[model samples]
Target: MSGTALLLVLAAAVCHASWNVVAHGVSRIGTPFLWWGAVASAVLWLPVVPFTGGLGGSVGGLALGAGVSAVLHVVYMVVLQRGYAAGSLSTVYATARGTGPAVSAVLAVLLLGERLSALAAIGIAVVVAGVVATGLVDRRPRQAPAPVDGAAAIADGAAAPASTGGASEEPAPRADAAPRRRRRLDPGIAWGLLTGLAIASYTIWDAHALRTWELSPVSFMVGVTAVEVLFYTATLGRRRRELLDVVRAHWPRVLAFGVLSPMSYILVLVAIQTTPVALVAPARETSVVMVAVFGALVLREGSVAKRLTASVVVLGGIALLAL
Candidate 1:
């Protein structure tokens, strides 16, 4: 990766983390996601609709790509919601984010006929291994005992004398005494895999389309966003009220999220146009580490040690990719 491409990928990583934090921090995930999509579509489409004269010629392919993307987005929303609801924020976010680029790299080779240098392939393997390790560690069981120290005294606020009770007679160790619950993998992880495939498909396809049609970046985003709005409204009409409520309550954050997301995608797309797809995809996965950090410090979730380690591993993988 060139210096400029690397910088752009880094910027995209920041944007990806920011939007995810906004999505998860909201009171309702589904509604915020919908609103984010709508606002993003409007932001991209409204300003440049008039200047898209050249885009008119490429409308068919752009629309087709957008249609595929919209479907993928629906799947993404579903998986993202379930992933956040059922698993640790760091674990699910790391898996989903890391998996997409990995899939993209593989698909780029097979479908797009892109070649990765031997070094780049090694880098991709290291990154994938790191992501897998993070997931494994995040899923391990934890032990958390109930608050027993507070109840060891009498009503007189004095310490109770110790009793030589047998080990089995020690209140039977509380029948409910069990290790802290390990979150179950969301069935959405499967959905997340599908979502990642969708993302990779459209990204590679769109990049090819852009090259063939020579569409300007602004116009391409506008067209894709317009089509996405139509598709989302058509398919998710049942959830309109929920979607609207989220938009009304968190309009500013939603708008910001929307704007940043497409901008991030645009940056990655541009980077791929110039750099190797293998390089760009792995570099983009750097967002996984960012999300893990956000989960620890910003979201204030538990498992700090695991998350920190995962973040380091992810960064290490990114470094390897740069080589």
Candidate 2:
């Protein structure tokens, strides 16, 4: 990679993590939050669309690629929002981001018939291992409830029936039941996997689109951002109130994510013009580590040390892939 491309990728990494932090902070709004962000992004980049080909320059095959990319991005946004809802930002983000490159690598080998060096293979393994460790294994330290003495248990049992017919004791078991049910379905891992798949799909489509159209990065991004905004807006489906609520409550985030999301990728697109996509993709994922740290420190997600360790391993693998 050229020095300028290297710097652009690094900047993109930081900006990517920063907006994700913004989104994670208000993930409760779900798809609405995402939609607003896309709206903002579309507005901001709209001017560039006219200058950079107005969503259809030298049209023939570019339309399909751009359309597919827009559809993929909508799915990516939904999965990311849901992932934030179901899991900690660090684990979900790390797992989702980490899964992308590994899957992308496999696709390259199987579909594109790309060859990797031994070092890149090892790197892919490390990335997969780290993702499993971070995403699947519940490493959060559980606080064991203090053990009750036999005498106290008997005393409590004896006293319970006289008061409200053991109502308090009944609710304890019922309350405990919900958490057990929740534990059975770990949405974090599931959503992470889905997010990874979406990333891989878009990566492949974008690669093909670039090769076919050879359009400038600015034009392509502007068109895609506009389409993403339209897609998300159309899918509101009885959720318009919820979307309005997000806009009212978190306009700053709407603006921040709006600018950051598209601009960050614009940087990557520029880098791709100068460097190979193989180099740019892995280099951009360095944000995975940054997102983990942001989750632990700014968001106060648990198991910071363990998550960071896993993030380091994943980043090592990504760096190897880039090399």
Candidate 3:
């Protein structure tokens, strides 16, 4: 990638992570925040849509791609919500986001006939390893206080008359509070996998669509945003009110996320158009590293040391890919 393209990718990575953090903070209303994001994004792309000429030869293909993208986005949103609910954002987001570009790279090879250099292959491996390590480390059991015996509880209650002893009466922690045994259908892992697949599908399909159609970027973006709005609105129905509530409650944040997300995507498209897909995809994956850092430092949600280490590993992978 040229220096300009690389810089644009980096900027997009930052935007990607920031918007994800914003999304994580949204009130849990299935599909509501998504609709809000779509609407906001559409508004942003509206002005540019007018500049795009009427649909031509590849318009159908692009529209079909947009429809596919909308479905994938819904799936991605579902998984993202489940993942955030079930696991630490640091771990789930990093793993999901990091694995996407690697999957995209493979799909690009199979479907788009894109090739990866040796360095890029190594970089992808490193990213995958880092994602695995991050997830495993998060799965480690957290310490819980031992259950208190009845006699001990009585004695502690009796001793509570004395200020010193009562001060020592630490509440017995419930065993149930311990991390639940990993189910066969671990929601976090499932969601992470789905997220990866959704993103991979989006990237691959979008790439093909772009190649097939000569539509201006703004026009393509508006079309996709419109499709997304219709899909989410139909799927969310009565629940749409709940989504509206979230928007009303957090309009500023939602709007910011909406702006950043589409802008980041636009930047990525620009970069991909200018550079090799191999280069742009891996570079964009660096958002995983940024998200890990943001989760640890900004969100303050996980073990700082583990998050930092995982982030470094992810960055190392990106570096290798860039080489």
Candidate whose TM-score is highest: 3
Cα lDDT tens digits for candidate 1, 93-181:
44665576788888888877888878778778777666656555545332221222211211100111112222332343444553322
Q: What is the C-alpha lDDT of each candidate?
A: 0.59, 0.63, 0.63
Q: In candidate 1, where is summed lDDT lowest over 10 consecutive residues?
A: 151-160
Regions of model 2 farther than 4 Å from truth = 1-4, 49-57, 77-95, 110-113, 131-191, 242-245, 273-278
TM-score of each: 0.73, 0.72, 0.75
Q: Report how far residue 5 has shifted in candidate 3, in Å.
A: 2.4
How does residue 150 of candidate 3 score in lDDT?
15
lDDT of 1: 0.59
Q: Among all windows of ten consecutive residues in candidate 2, which has the lowest summed lDDT?
A: 153-162
Ranking by TM-score: 3, 1, 2
Once superposed on the true structure, which residue ranges of model 1 sit more than 4 Å away at CA? Answer: 27-33, 48-57, 78-94, 140-192, 236-239, 242-244
Cα deviation of 92 in candidate 2 (Å)? Answer: 5.8
Per-candidate clash tally: 0, 0, 0
Model 1 scores a TM of: 0.73
Task: Give the candidate order by descending lDDT.
Answer: 3, 2, 1
